[model samples]
Target: MLLTVSGPPGSGKSTTAAALAEAFDLEHVSGGDIFRELAAERDMTPVEFNELAEEDDQIDRDLDRRLRDVAVERDDVLLESRLAGWLAGDHADLRIWLDAPLDVRCERITDREEKPLDQVIEETRRRESSEAKRYREYYNIHIDNLSIYDLVYNTARWSPEGMLGMLTTAIDSYDPDTDEGKIPVEGVDYDF
Candidate 1:
């Protein structure tokens, strides 16, 4: 089962992906971790690296390419990234987008990063804007659009455990051969 979990900053995507991987006994790969590692190797912070990437498109391209490669090479892997769903495309058995209110997300970021809520809010806004612009320019994809995702979850209302239970049930019941387990992709819907 190739699962891709995508969301904006502080939406609990990493935690959710990790939990999903454990539950399904699948390898978990995080694009954020990869990006952070690269940034740290260069003695730069995530914001600094993100700013640099705006000028050097190759940085984003390379990271996205690596994600694609992983999807192609691995069969039972859970990928967590801002663009994981887009990158994995049809290869992913399940594509989930986690959504949360901006204030809620900022609060989560503040708590996780041990930073002031205002600072985290500003940082997240800047980072997301930069990424949205770059993604649109490079891939013709609007980050705000959730049309491509198979399932969208509102993280604010659902606790991590609740979300996990929902995902587990979906995964357990899914039948790939008959497409019986796939969520309907018609309406703009979210699972709470």
Candidate 2:
């Protein structure tokens, strides 16, 4: 079962995806982790690397291509990324999207990163804006579109445990016999 967990930063994507992988006995690959690793390799922070990615499109292409390949090549895997759903295409059994309001997400990020609320908010806003523009320009993907996802949850309303339980229930309850199959993301370029 190839599953995808997707959302903006601080939406608990990595946390939930990791939990899902453990529960389902699946290999997990996180695009955020990969990006951060790459950033560190160059002695740069994620925000700095993101700015570089905005200039050099290959940075995103390489990362996204690897993620897309993993989704296609691996069966028992949980792929988590901003574009995992779109990149996974028809290969994924369940594509989940998580989100929270901006303020809620900013608070989560502040707590996780141990940063000031205002600084985190500014960085997050800039990062999100840069990424959205790059996604649109490079792949014709609109990051705001949630129609292709099998599950879309707002993280603000639930505790992390509650959210994970909800996701596990959905994964556990999937019935291929009654399954309608994936919703094709129309007009996505998927060039990366």
Candidate 3:
């Protein structure tokens, strides 16, 4: 079973994905983690790395290509990223989108990153805007579109454990044979 957890910054996507991976005994792969590692390796912050990515599109392509390949080739994996739903395409058994109001997301980011709320808010907005532009430029995708996903939840509505429980219930309730949840992404060529 392939599952995808996608959301903007600090929407509890990683937290939920980790719990889901444990609950289902699935491999957890996070694109954000990979990106962060790359950033750290180069002695740069994620914001810096993102700015570089905007100038050098290859960075985004390389990371996204690897993710798309994994989604197509692997099963029993929980993929987490901003664009995991689009990247997984039809290979995913279930695609989930988690989001919250801007203020709520900014607070979570501030808590997670241990940064000032003002700084967190600015950086998060810049990062999301950069990603949205890149997504459109490379894939012709509208990043805000949520129609492709099977489940869309607002993480602000629940605690970490509560969100996990709700997600697990949704996953358990899925009937692959009957539910037509795999919405194949079309018109965008994933040219790896």
Candidate 4:
């Protein structure tokens, strides 16, 4: 089972993914962590890192390939990336998209990074705008589309455990191994 979790920055994607992977005994792969490592290796600031990411398409491709390879070989893998679900293609068994209000997200960012609230808000806006434009320009898919996901969770209202439990139960309910077994999420068709 390949579970792809994606959301805006500070939306608890990493936290949720980690919790889900731990609770379900799935391998957890975080693209943000990978990018951070890459940035540190290059000795770049956040803006520099973003520019480098834009210039090097191979980084994204390699990460996509890694996720695909994991899906093909692993029984259960949980991937957290901005574009994980879209990149996973048919290999994604359960895809979740988390969302929260812009203000809520900005507050989370400020709290997490201990930055000035205004600075965090501006930075968050800039980052999200860049990501949205770049994802569309590069992948020909809009990450903002809620219909692309198997489950859409409003992070503002749900605790991490609540969200993880909901997603896990949804996946288990659809597991073909159970008595009320249903096909894996890969078999489910999306209108898109």
Candidate 5:
């Protein structure tokens, strides 16, 4: 059971992924955590490392390659990242995209990073814009397009626990033998 959780900054993806991993007893991996560790190793902030990556595309490629490798080499893993859904692609049993309003996301980030709301908002905008440009140039991917995802949820409307419950229910109800996995179609508005 491989799950990929992809979302923009502060959409509660990491929190939901962590909970799902625990509930399902799967190994949890976060691309952002790995990137942050690498950034710290080089004594640079995430923004600085992202800037460096812009100059050297290998950084992004390497991270994405590692993600792909993990999907191919492992099962019972929950992978979380901005591009996790695309990287995992058909290999994932469940590919979820979480979204929230920009203001809500900014507020979450402000609380999580202990930064001012305005500062967090500006930083998130800059970072997301940079990532979108690099992802387009590097992978020919349009990050804003959610067509590839199996399930899309608006995280702003649910608590982390609520989201987890909904996801677990969906996972539990999946029937692999019948090829009827209760997977939601792209662009469908889910009442949950």
Candidate 6:
């Protein structure tokens, strides 16, 4: 089964995805991390990389398609990405959306980058808007809405243990063949 985790920047998607993958013993891949690695190989800033991603639709689509194909063939896979659920087409057994407040996300960005909170907040906001616009224009994808997900979680209120509890329950209850369960992860925290 394929489990896809997605969210905006600093939404704890990576942490949750990693934890879930470890606990579930699933293969994991993070699209954002992959993009960052690729960018570093090219010595590009996030803005420059995003610009290139915007220009290269086939490259982005192909990467996602290949990843989805792998997920489909694998016994268990966890995909962490901004657009994994959408890109995975019908292969994803569960699509989880992680979310947090703008202020919380800003603080997370500041801490993660070691930048001033205000500066990081502004940059993050700008990045989010730009990515949203670009995704819409390039792939007709609308990520602002949360309804497309099989599950939605607000990490601001739930502790990591709480998240794990919810995920465990969902995994236990979810039927891969029939999507009929609610996975609610609220207020999940990460030590790292």
Mind giving the per-residue lDDT tens digits that candidate 5 earns over 1-192?
A: 899999998999999999999999999999999999989999997877888889988888888889888987999999999988878766788889999999999999888889999888887888888899888787777899888787899999998889999999988876655645434334321111
Better of 1 and 4 by lDDT: 1
Candidate 3 regions with alpha-carbon error over 4 angstroms: 179-181
Q: Model 6 lDDT vs. the true structure? A: 0.77
The per-model lDDT (C-alpha) reads 0.87, 0.92, 0.92, 0.75, 0.85, 0.77
Candidate 3 vs 4: which has more TM-score: 3
Kindly list the per-residue Cα lDDT of model 6 for residues 90-138, writing each as its tens digit. Answer: 6677888899999998898788889899887777877787778766775
Clash count (model 3, backbone only): 0
Ranking by TM-score: 3, 2, 1, 5, 6, 4
lDDT for each residue of candidate 3 in 29-85, tens digit (9 for 90 to 100): 999999999999999999889989999999999999999988999889999999899
How far off is residue 74 in model 6, in Å?
Answer: 2.8
Clashing pairs in 5: none
TM-score of 2: 0.96
The weakest ten consecutive residues by lDDT in model 2 span: 176-185
Question: In model 5, where do residues sit more than 4 Å from their true spots?
Answer: 178-192
lDDT at 53, model 3? 96
TM-score of 5: 0.91
Worst 10 contiguous positions by lDDT, candidate 6 = 183-192
**In candidate 6, which residue pairs get closer than 3 Å at backbone N, Cα or C atoms, i.e. clash?**
157-187, 158-186, 158-187, 158-188, 159-187, 160-189
lDDT tens readout by residue for model 1, 47-142: 888888999989998898899899878999999999888887777898999989999999998888899998888888889988998887788778
